[model samples]
Target: MRILVTNDDGIFAEGIYDLAKALQDIGEVIVAAPNSERSATGHAITIHHPLRVDKVRFFDTTIEAYSISGTPADCVKLAVEALLKDRRPDIVISGINNGPNLGTDVIYSGTVSAAVEAAIMDIDSIAISMGSTNITQYTDAANFVCRIAKEIIHNNDIKDTIININYPTCPKEEVKGVKVTTLGVRKYENTFIERKDPRGNSYYWTSGNVVDMEQNQDSDILALQNGYISITPIHFDLTHFKTFEKIKKLNFQK
Candidate 1:
């Protein structure tokens, strides 16, 4: 089996590197990721500027890697369309992201976007994230992802959905179990922070704190809060099913 591994955390991130190493024993691993961190970039693609891909050495692994001047989605697009045109990978796995992609956070995550892009291309894909800012060790997350990837590659039923997994920031033994969940709501305290440059020009920075929600046992947030790995099946479709019938009932000009 051949696996295409990518992430929003750049090619040299510890998370990506660890994940690649772990999967190497299972299959041929290929790393195609951003040259720099592109966290929270969503599904944006590069349109105007010409994209450049450079091959560089990352740690001990002499893997063929690329650094593209684009978003995470663009990296996956360019990889399949241009880089790996001759051989299509069996699956695409994005991230062991620096932080968890729970609740509405997935909407803005480039880590998840890369996986979504792969799924749009009709390949099985998954986005893996660790629910912590301080990521000292990634082995546990990598192993967990490897186990899921193996199951996904073999099972036809699991291939029908795109997976977004979030691991809590605790010892593997402390993890209760895995929970299949839905996206949760994340209210924010603030969206932006105003700052002044040394030249006195004012600029805004995006920063916010996660808002607590009332206990909803089925949500990703709640699952993570309770020390369980959250696996939320995500899709590219943005149709609001609840509002669809209501909108259909409204009469409009023919």
Candidate 2:
């Protein structure tokens, strides 16, 4: 099996390294990611400027990796379209992201965007994240992906759905189990601090406090809060089928 690994965090991030290293035993792992961090850069592709790629030494050349000047979506697009064009990978795994991408956070997540890109190309993908920012280990997350990837590759039932997973920061032993869940609501108390630069130029720095707004018992957010790994299968179709007729009722002309 061949796998394409990527992340929104720059290639140097510990999460991606641990993930790629762990998956090496499973298959040929290719790492193509942004040279610098591109966190929260959703579904964006760089088209105006010519992309630059550098063949960097990662893991002593045992695995092929490249640092590209683009977002997470760009990395996956370039890898499949150009870098590995001759032999496309069977699956694309977009993270062991530095932080959890749950509920509405996936909308702005570069990590999830990479997986979405793969799904667009009709390839199975998984976006795995760790729920805690204070943790250092990613082995459990990596191992979990390996196990799930085997099921996805051989099982056609899981096709066309992008798997979104979030493992809590607690130790592996503390994890209760996996929960198949729905997208939950996550909000933030957004704040922007106004400050003056050394040259007296005023600018605003972005910051926010995350708020768990999920009240549903079967939501991914609630599952993570209860010490369980949350796995939410998502599809790209944005049609609100439930409200399709509601909007159609406001019919204008034929």
Best-performing candidate as measured by TM-score: 2
lDDT of 2 by residue, 1-254 (tens): 89999999999888889999989889999999999999999999999999999988885447799999999999999999999999799999998898899998899999999999999998999999999797869999999999998889898888888999999999989999999999998899999999999999999999999875646899999999899999999988889999999998985886
Report the Cα lDDT for residue 213, model 1: 76
lDDT assessment of candidate 1: 0.89
lDDT per residue for candidate 1 within 137-175, as digits (tens), equals 899989989999999988887654679999988988899
Q: What is the lDDT of residue 137 in candidate 2?
A: 91
After superposition on all C-alphas, the RMSD of every candidate to the true structure, in Å, is 1.6, 1.4
lDDT of 2: 0.92
Model 2 regions lying over 4 Å from their true place: 198-200
Backbone clashes in each candidate structure, one number apiece?
0, 0
Candidates' TM-scores?
0.95, 0.96
Query: lDDT of each prediction vs. the true structure?
Result: 0.89, 0.92
